[model samples]
Target chain A: MACVDDKGQLTASARKLLETIENNALTPEEIAKEAALPLFKVRSSMRDMKSMGFVTEEENGAYQMNPEASKLLKK
Target chain B: MSEETMSQVNSLPRIGSKAPNFEATTTHGTLQLSDYEGSWVILFSHPADFTPVCTSEFISFQNIYPKLREMNTELLGLSVDSVSSHIAWVRNVKEKFGVEIEFPIIADLNKEVAEKYGMIMPEESSTETSRAVFIIDGQRTVRAIIYYPLSTGRNMDEILRVITALQATDEHNIATPADWKKGDKVIVPPANTAEMAEERVNDDSVECIDWYYCQKEI
Candidate 1:
């Protein structure tokens, strides 16, 4: 997990992906394009990040960075 | 099949071994591995076309294409998809992401290249390739290989960093430390003999934690 730490917090890749999703509600493909990550990676990371409350899935199935992730990114 | 023949067919190229050559159809055109001679190559494989993860990986690879070219390297993507599937997927990616994927993508429908590279891990998926990366030098030797499970995406920054580190080591005969990026101090190869170790003790040019571990500016 290049984007996660031992404490289960977001690191480089996770943080970058979150930043890409900050204001934009995007599909996995869109997120992968925006974040410059592989689509498979974005899907998997989003799953983990979402479960950790770092991101949220909208009714339309797009993803957005949650408030918790924003705070962590700010740091 | 004999054990020896099976091993030869299934085994992946080891570091320092010659990269197996192949000719295949790509989005750009038909290409052979030998065509990339005299340039470094980052040969990678994805699971499928039009899939989310593979799409993102392609986009990311596109983002780094320029940097790789600047380093005298070429990017070649591959999958078990057909040439038509690869073409359609490329079109979709360009139209959707506004990214033009300029690299060639090998359509390994027959799984010939996949078999040679051992890209398909049956435990993960019988039909699809796990994410695999092979870095080959200008001389066509396999320099580095990285593999990720079907679900995980690769770290683009790390990929670039590794290429940089490998090039640096080849040029300067120095090794990188953990999490080492460009401009960071590199580890000097340990002294080979006691006499050289004694000479290394007084070498003021580098910061030595011990005879075997020393750091020096590039």
Candidate 2:
């Protein structure tokens, strides 16, 4: 049903992580490097975004933006 | 706090009590326990994702999903893993086992659902949930609860049989014998009065081994 919060908002760190995964699936380390954030922050943001159904994990332990997340990005 | 006190605080939902409700992110979508208000729910929790035992259990659950649906039941799986891990595991299971898990799996990283369901047995493992199954009826009341140690896999046939038995008992006011299956004779409730006990002896419709033990055909 309501996949996102009432505000349909993503934190700045979450948005950075989501943008990195929007094109290619990447592990937390890679996302941190690409987003210029620390690895620990990327990891925590990924967990938060994942619970919101924004990103999904690949078989290789890489994270990618789900379709629901893509829609959010477009909006 | 003492172990006993901690356990008492996180005790499992008792049978005949209302199932605790929660909103969780799942593989299918964000869903609440109230979503399946008019159907039976098999809310099960595994220890983790990608583990061998949990993987096999997921496959087994997928195999019986159709059968359960036929009985107006829905399956919802849970683990303390993140949603990303759950998605990865689901894909892996499909590729390796050739069984697609159609049911939604709750990603309980916060352990909200697990704590409410008393799935995490502290004695077993503080971080992971034990193999727990809660069968909630259409009315959202818990009808049965089965818990297995982390090592032992659950029995699908037994789960199905119990659902059948519960349904039959509700429909006919009867009880099921040990190892009972569908189409088998069901036991009648024991008579409480002397006259009813006497009538049970003369009731040809039922087979009575004793006054308290009587069975009738469904």
Candidate 3:
């Protein structure tokens, strides 16, 4: 696998998911269902988003959208 | 399909006009044609990076890379494959075909670049892109364009001939005739009147077949 760029930005797939989840908090399963992504893709995207500071996961297993991703969605 | 349908298919990124600027993360990271402002760009799209037909085409392009570079042109390839897939394909081409590709190929996983360039046709292949080539001048204006069917491979000789023809026209302000090849006689546009035609024959350098037909050795 290729290493991420040093900027900590999301890869293309991760970016697409962040774009999808900007409006509201969605669990990995919900993200996979709504975005037409597979389960593994949702997990990978969530991990990348969390690392890039674009998402935060709750103790109850829900993912919350971060402000950066929210701003991108508004645009 | 009909010519009208093909023209409609290629209408998104208008041919014989400026190619649209597209920024995408390729196998070599973020790239854009605007970055190479002072040189020519040959941006081509393949069905998929690792497929058999595309592999041969890529190797052919790579073999011609040195010549293209000598003419101050750069090549950029594209497909709707992941960057890792592109990397693997490049390695495969080098190892098996004995040619090294020294250009960046856009991954275009989301089909953004392909859509922007009209490279993807759902009617052609729902999951793959069509074979597309756009030759842009130093000013980022498209000079020539060619599209090949999925099964038929592109002619590298024809591509080189077109570049030579375009460059010659730009330098000499002359137009080439149909099926023009390098070092072959070039067509001189007929002068409008009999007086100009009479003067053209006496010019000595140009061969006049008739009053309207004049050929010049390039």
Index of the highest-TM-score prediction: 2
Ranking by DockQ: 2, 3, 1
Docking class of 3: incorrect
Tens-place lDDT digits, model 3, residues B66-92: 899888787889988888899898988
**Pairs in clash, predicted candidate 3:** none
What are the candidates' interface root-mean-square deviations? Answer: 14.1, 12.3, 12.0
DockQ of each: 0.01, 0.07, 0.02
- TM-scores across all candidates? 0.73, 0.73, 0.69
| CA shift of B192, model 1, Å | 1.3
- The candidate, 1 or 3, that scores higher on TM-score is 1
Model 1: residues >4 Å from true position, as ranges?
A1-75, B1-5
Name the TM-score of chain A in model 3.
0.71
Compared with the true structure, what per-residue lDDT tens digits does model 2 show for residues A1-75? 223446876545566667788889998778877997534345545666777678888888699889778777666
1 versus 3: better lDDT goes to: 1
Flag regions of model 2 displaced more than 4 Å.
A1-75, B1-11
By DockQ, the best candidate is 2
**Ten consecutive residues with minimal summed lDDT in candidate 3 chain B?**
B28-37
Question: What is candidate 1's CA lDDT for residue B38?
Answer: 67
Better of 1 and 2 by TM-score: 2
Off by over 4 Å in 3: A1-75, B1-11, B193-195
